[model samples]
Target chain A: MSEVTRPTLSDALTERMLELIRTGGHRPGDRLPSTRELSQRFAVTTPTLREALRRLEATGAIEMRHGSGIYVGADIERLVLPNPNMREIHAAQLLELLGARIVIEPPLAALAAEHAGGEELSALQRVLDEAGRHLRGEDAELHDANMTFHRATARMAGNSVLNEVVDSLLTVHGPEQREILQIFDDRRRDYEEHLAILEAIEARDAAQAESRMRAHLVDVKTVIEHRLQSPR
Target chain B: MSEVTRPTLSDALTERMLELIRTGGHRPGDRLPSTRELSQRFAVTTPTLREALRRLEATGAIEMRHGSGIYVGADIERLVLPNPNMREIHAAQLLELLGARIVIEPPLAALAAEHAGGEELSALQRVLDEAGRHLRGEDAELHDANMTFHRATARMAGNSVLNEVVDSLLTVHGPEQREILQIFDDRRRDYEEHLAILEAIEARDAAQAESRMRAHLVDVKTVIEHRLQSPR
Candidate 1:
């Protein structure tokens, strides 16, 4: 190992790299110098530079394509992120996650109703239609469609930070949510609830959209709670 | 450099490290085997191990003390985290952040009012008191106290996930928020608003607490918005 491989060296290099990005005004997808070039510029050996790059990559600060070069990551500017290291969530945490969605997503739905543009509304309709076709189809496709619907509505609320927060929650909720589709087992009702939310949004009925969202999430949580108490 | 210093090796090592942490049933702050032992166990060189360790450290999946060994990170299980690499916020992103808080925090304040126990309420009161003392003092201290007040109220709301979300927001909002304090420039009113929210929580008046919290954040956001329009 190089003498420069100490933790402090890596920490300093991370800070310097961030400074370089900021000073260079590199936006997401903008390329940074190559690893070899970066090491030469920073006067560090390749191992130390690689360690810093991995740290940046782990947190979505930067991207490192193997044969390609480095680029700023899309999530670098996001205020919130899903814990990338989360492998599994316990039952209690899963319910708490739903509770958070209950508190958060409803208001965003109301905002979506108030603010959604014509193009946005049609796109949202398309997402629901996709979900409808997959209602009886594979779990993964339906789950993706379902998640996209929630994400699109949150985006329509016109607050990127809230959108990031909701996206992070859904991303971390991924596996359990798929299992939720299996256990909640009312794929039709689930699809219908989502449709109701979409209709309310399309009609620009903010109150109706908000209440429907709350009801839908509460229903899902209630079913999950009951199932958890007596697992099949 | 070792032949194993490739990006794929680093990625594989990161996954293996996560597996080790999970399969070993380690909780936050639990000590893991030393780097030498971990290297021996995993059959990778020290440089590869260090790269993985740095990635984990950056994301708070693990902590590496300088001379001490590694411990599982407290944030490993959290569903949401502040983006650790956020260096600065643009004026627009900052406004959107406040808008997000306006949507999310009010409901939490109401929940805090409904669910806060005597001890938790007292603790929240103490946080505000700390803020009060620093009202005319250093900006950083007052900022810390105010943040603690918000975080404690979110915690008292009894949802860990929401608390994580709020904490993440506040964490990323740190530096810009201090600048906001100077711009908003009503230290006394800021302190007073926090007191009113705490009072409503203590009174267990959920409606009053929620509205007060909402109005307070709106007040701050309005001031910041105006200031951003015409900077000092």
Candidate 2:
């Protein structure tokens, strides 16, 4: 048998500290207990506790403010992948990405309807109103508006990890939508779908919100499929 | 407005090369064109091409072997997060993670039943038999076997990105599983459900595979919920 190497004391403490942050009823920007207190609680020396805190800081799971105290940073659970370059995306890849979004987003919309607070609901309303104005205008930035609407809906779902994954998926969806920009000629239909989804959200109708979102994606998918089938 | 700095020549070349890797007919382990040939094709100097190659290597999208030509590595699409430290997982977090799996895995099972080959199906059957032996012997390595079963199902789905994500999910599932190991008292029932799901896959019944997988997860979720509600 190969030799076993035990984990260093600091490494174990770092994991314990991270666990506390995750389940310790602490939010972002919440202060951690002082070094002296932490050391006593863990029954370790002050230097060892400081070593653990230093490691946590490196993982983006905690922040040490000079003279104030240690506070939680955005943390590992919040790290998102870099935005993918759209010019590099292939049609098949984009379609696969959209298929993934189709699977994930409707459920997210349902969760949003079940979870959104007044603040999140108003944020959704603001995005919808802005998107509507853009759709009505002659020089509309419809792509950005559409992305904003979906991203906002993701945020309303209240699961940080899911919200981040949806954002990454949209990095592909945003560009693909742009590639098929001309197919969204039915501006009124697009606007009404957005409004319907928003109304379902506002009414706290989870099932309706889910179905509306799914229907919207299916429409977009059909346009994309048509574009892929026909040559430019 | 911030000052606009144009991307360096190497950065542009890197993006172009990555684009080639994505859209090019190159699969993992396929040899890339010679550096001299590629530089000539792109009209870029050799140093710029080398810099770009370096970047791709760093991103894990390609590999370089001494005395041999450059080859496509595993690519960005296959990178999965490391297994999490389960000692840090909380009951609520485990429940939420299980819920995410419930939402995602049934569809994956359906996809798998559509895509699995004779070899893949046989591999799955082998895993089930091994797990059953462990259960019958009362020396069960249930956790590893359970993960192997789900991960194999994910692989059979034939979606690289989804498979990678499922692997990462199993990282959490693997360890949280150990924490709740006691609740799995009905090992025979667990084995039977897996067999049922595998039978659906072997029969190529996508809908039945999906429903069976969903029912299995719901059972696991119920167990987790019961555990969370009552203390030992």
Candidate 3:
């Protein structure tokens, strides 16, 4: 007999899979067994197995490798706290987390501005510029570019904790979560907002950079609220 | 013979024990094996077993029945993230976590102000008063009370997702983090700052409250930076 019996199949497979991934049993780049094999062993149908896998992918847990196979993702699991049950709006939680951000990131950006070699800044600059190129024209490419700049800033900070947490923010908006960008008819405003924040960071004006980054998130919040009111 | 075997006897016991707790293989609150019994069953000495058992208990993975026997502990082990790792200031992770906080929190406070009710506001009042009592006198007590007041406000916001995030922030504070409170010579001044922020919230002066909070945090940031600069 195998050292351990397989996990039982159920509607909660997605959650169980997540539990496995988060608990470190599933390392990045570990290939999952084929869906057929997994289903047969777990006594679940192929469709059921696929359903859980789909959600996992959506959350950036596992990636589909096309002809290759499904594998655990690298560095995708960021410091996302477990969500509380949905009843309250969790405002203070929001404020506390935000307060911490304001205190930390401005310094990181300032450090980046002073220490990041030209190559790093240019890479970030390129991301901002590319995001500008497709504003309101198309979203997927622009969104990716925007993320690249944020990650680049983290890389410049030389802090893994900072880098991982920022990326985790993007994780919350994982696959299809980007449907939020559709809320604004003229997302050019948001792009311009990003431009202001980046420019301040580049200028090594830490305070201005923090302020603009915050100002930009205001639009983001507005867009998020609108999208939630009537999903696309 | 027992089917379970491992490279190390302690490793096998740890695995079996976690499986027992997580799978409810043993009922909650049920007393577990004595060290003597565990050592005999696993063919390991008491010290090796103690090391494994200690690891589990430290993580809240299990509980000793207090001169009784070991039992299953609270399910802190269920959490996906290791908060202790994320909270260390000297370590490199704080900045990233803070970045995520920035994006989600300011609006949370504004929303909390918009929605916090009488009972919740009254609770905040009580916590503030209690916190004020010890602010200048005992540093440890003051930090605890101050955190209580802050947490009370978040609890008032009634948002689960936001609250969960805030809980993470609480876990990140330094073990002797309260020692920094002495940096402000007159604790009364800090308490008054807290009172002003509370009043601002109570009066529904969202702008004033937010302004006060940001200002208070800026002073705190300077103190913390100064402390970090000093010898450990």
Best candidate according to TM-score: 1
Candidate 3 DockQ vs. native = 0.06
Off by over 4 Å in 1: A1-5, B1-5
TM-score of 2: 0.68
Q: Note the chain A TM-score of all models in turn.
A: 0.97, 0.64, 0.55
A74 Cα displacement, candidate 1 (Å): 1.0
Model-by-model DockQ, in order: 0.61, 0.10, 0.06
lDDT of 3 by residue, A2-68 (tens): 2111223322675556665556466788977776666675677654565455435433457755556
Q: Candidate 1, which CAPRI tier?
A: medium
Q: What are the root-mean-square deviations of the candidates from the true structure over C-alphas?
A: 1.8, 8.7, 13.3
Q: Report the C-alpha displacement of residue B148, candidate 3, in angstroms.
A: 1.6
Worst 10 residues of 3 chain B by lDDT: B79-88
lDDT against the true structure, per candidate, is: 0.93, 0.70, 0.56
lDDT at residue A37 of model 3 (Cα atoms): 65
Q: Could you tell me how far off, in angstroms, the CA of residue A22 lies in candidate 3 after the best superposition?
A: 22
TM-score of 3: 0.51
- In terms of DockQ, the best-performing candidate is 1
Interface RMSD of 2: 11.8
Per-residue lDDT of B1-232 in model 1, one digit per residue for the tens? 3322378888888899899999999999999888888889989988788888898998899998777778899999899999999988999999999999999999999999999999998888889889988988999999999999999999999999999999999999799999989998999999999999999999999999999999999999999999999987
Q: Could you give candidate 3's per-residue lDDT for residues B1-232 as a string of tens digits? A: 1121122544466676666554655645666777677668767765556545644553455665444667776433222222322222442234333343333344455555777899888888888878867755667778888777666655555554345455556555544346446554557767887788788778887777666765665655555555556835
DockQ of 2: 0.10
